[model samples]
Target: MQKKTDFYFTYPPNLQELDLATMVSMYRDRGEPRKAAPGKYLACAVTHKLLKEAKWWFGLYYSQAAWDELLTKGSEGYPLTEAELNLLGLVLSSETPPHREYVEKNIGTLPKLAYLIVNDIKQFGFLQEDEHGYLRITPRGERALQGISRRIYQKRFTAEMLVVYHESEELHRDDDQRNDQATLF
Candidate 1:
């Protein structure tokens, strides 16, 4: 049997005044790339879950663009967490804007947890609140959920079901427009 390992994702090393988390948030939320040194990009949509993965960077030199291609857009990365997807699914299932109270009550997730997820959803422009304070799914949100559905429907017969990428890159170039749709391995 293969020795299976669980991998976690995080930002690349940022050789700057800002801390790693802040730098990463800026790059991820603003969609900007920063070059830490010549031929080495520190933070950007192009590179992610970086540096630490380089346990032995002796010969693991790659351009910023290439790194983005491998990690961010490559076979083993996804930008969204499961919580965000769940919230999106809830919103899509409703014919109208689902109230936040309803979502909280139905899911039984703590209000704080639900708030954070909804905040992330709003930040990504996936879902928006109507004037009446009900949560409505945006076109982008629909597309994200639909994209997953479509991919699963197409790959139903196959053994591949690990990766189902969100449709974010094509429309929003500034925030979370990364090429990573799903994980491959």
Candidate 2:
């Protein structure tokens, strides 16, 4: 039989900063290639879970341009089209509430722009939109940009939880074996 092992957070290496490319790489280790976007609902749920645990900053790395880029298009790594890049640039530099003219002059329509931004905030959690519809950085958002949190360092380690549960069960089995051995002796 294969040796059983505990799969919990045993390794304590310092977490490193990660970008979207690195995030895709991290997920790849677990079997998937890449998670696509328009993922607002999913991103919101996952990031909210992280935020609830105060781990949002640690668990994810983000770029202002990258996120807005994903919202406008689908992926971030590829070179953006002029319109896409322009929209991304506008969002990255804007503040909370954002400028109406800025978006219209650059992107367009509140609903359309909000749709993208809401999703970005959902995934990344917390965005600063200016009265003029400009998006600046929030403290939380800034932390993500800087790669200061460790939560993003690990792949979403589901196996660790399962391994821990199984390890406990195994310990019980070992205890039963010990009892049996003692009774035999």
Candidate 3:
């Protein structure tokens, strides 16, 4: 007679518990992307968030006339003293001619302008102070100015927000599709 062999099954004591934990872990991990492109995602997120906040500020008060005057008449690359910006902001904010006249009177006086600049416009990042205690527009400031100008002139600021969000979504989708296709092979 031919010899017969019998097989016996064995299981780990915690097999069920281990399997459950592994599955839960896998499901949780699968929700997040294994590899996300650097900078692009972060840039998109920040741009979207900031643009939304910026829209409100742009609408509420952006001194177009003052901005135009500064850009066109003021000296480029030369530091615009904090005093100068304070006077400009004051003049722009004034609704009545009398108020504007009063603010304009302080334009030439350094002390008045000094106090106004220290209290108000100095906090903005676009204007940076140099060792000489003078403030100038940074490259970031220039870009911000241009963006605000465009938004004001074009009347498409809200639409631009949607465009940015959609473009980022499309880029992310494309990356996912590419990843999926690569895995298929």
Candidate 4:
């Protein structure tokens, strides 16, 4: 009835560390996604925001690159399908901000899975699509992305350093102590 895992468990990268407000503003400024069916637009908007930020962090300046990378990187946990990638591509590249018609024509029908991605990010304080479809990234998101990665890297590096340090230190353990142990034997 249960299973045991030998590997360590890790939490999903904190969503609170990304930049959400700027992302939402990018959507409004671009003026696209104005047309995905009513409730769907907001969810799309929030998902787009998080994806873009992740791409930026990953060194992808364009949404197309970001979408590809996001989907690839997220596959292990949050798998994104073709339809979702299409929607994200539209939102990320929204120059005139394509409405529902534009998205449908470009990406075909939207799927329900997109909502799960948005909701997952929101659970960690990424953003919530309002009734009007607006989104805002929480401060936690900014810190999580900007700060957590570096901190985690440092922590791992430090652990490794400590191992080396301890090993090196062991080499210097008092020779007299060794002699004493040998004599007892």
Candidate 5:
């Protein structure tokens, strides 16, 4: 007779606190276990454990008011530029497509505001352009506002925005330094 082997696995006690939904979302968001069928996503033990730890830091730093201020207002106590706030609010508040002329008149020229709105739409997956070329808020964007009230989604979005801003600033500084060195040479 041949002997049979069985595999066993154990999870850390701390991971028990992360509920199934959060785990599923974390896994899906990370795009792990590639090509997993719907309702069949399985996170590896290491990924599951790390998500458990990450949840703590999510709540530790991000607050609803802070993110709201960052979104509606700009960071560091500076109010969002009139164009920035207006453009964001217009799309978020209305499903109807406002005319391009109206947007340009009220929100300033497209060139002036396009970079901010375009970058936000790309990075956050919160806005989409309609077939008619009108912009609209996506389901994810609606979730962001809803989450703002609950404070969960708000934190994640705000953290992501901060990271992007910091990276852009660092890149700009590096470019400046390179230019200075070129001038010196």
Candidate 6:
């Protein structure tokens, strides 16, 4: 039978320095059958894109700082992945025109991935190509980058707090160990 929990977690500051994997492993059930699910995972294992609802579910009121910050801000447009944000930030900081080749050199990604990210940025209207094939960030792109930066900061900060909060808990060890086990609430 599945158990229900109302385990409200609050993240703490100084969380970036903590060993999240170890902390998470501490709660692991070592000997039983694996209970992890494909799409479900602990918050620290941020491998794929996470749902926006996560911000509300795991952060915010659970982490008071996140909650206060949430009240002080409004949402931005569609979120960008880490790669997307990195490309945007690079373009925004460029003193000279950055072409696709330049991005590959600086961003340190495979050429194909760099091409796709550049094109994606253009599709979002945050970047443009000049007659010489140089890339430029538009005014709208600047605004978008700003919004993305803020969004990323909020997510990271809140996640840190959530980890710290969980670290203080007195959790029991069980035998079921799964990385992506969805919580059945």
Model 4 / residue 31 / CA error / Å: 34
- After TM-score superposition, the amount by which residue 150's alpha carbon in candidate 1 deviates from its true location, in angstroms, is 6.3
* Number of clashes recorded per candidate: 2, 27, 0, 15, 0, 9
Which lDDT value does model 3 have at 134? 43
Q: Per-residue alpha-carbon lDDT of model 2 for 114-158, expressed as tens digits?
A: 354344553454455555555554554433332211122222212
Compared with the true structure, model 6 gives a TM-score of 0.41
Write down the RMSD of candidate 6 (Cα, Å).
19.5
- Residue-level lDDT for 63 in candidate 1: 42
Clashing pairs in 3: none
Candidate 1 lDDT over 1-185, as tens digits, reads 11122121222333245654654454444222333455553322234434312221212333444444333211122333334445666676667778877665443244444565576667768788877769888877766654433333422111122112122232455344343443322
lDDT of 3 by residue, 4-65 (tens): 21111111223234444553453233212222244332111212321211111111211223
Q: For model 3, what is the alpha-carbon lDDT of residue 123?
A: 55
Runs in model 5 lying further than 4 Å from the true structure: 1-84, 99-101, 108-111, 143-185
- Report the C-alpha lDDT of model 5 over 23-59, residue by residue, as the tens digit: 4443233311233345553233323421212211212
Question: How do the predictions measure up, each by TM-score?
Answer: 0.41, 0.22, 0.22, 0.24, 0.29, 0.41
Candidate 4: C-alpha lDDT: 0.35
Tell me the lDDT of candidate 5.
Answer: 0.39
Stretch of 10 with least lDDT, candidate 2 = 49-58
- TM-score for model 2? 0.22
lDDT of 2: 0.35
- In terms of TM-score, how similar is model 4 to the real structure? 0.24
Which residue pairs show collisions in model 5? none
Give, for candidate 6, the lowest lDDT window spanning 10 residues. Answer: 1-10
lDDT of 6 by residue, 1-185 (tens): 11122121222333344464643342131111222256763232222333222233212211223323432122133334444545666666667877767765454344454565577678768789887778887877666655544555533122222222233232322223232254542
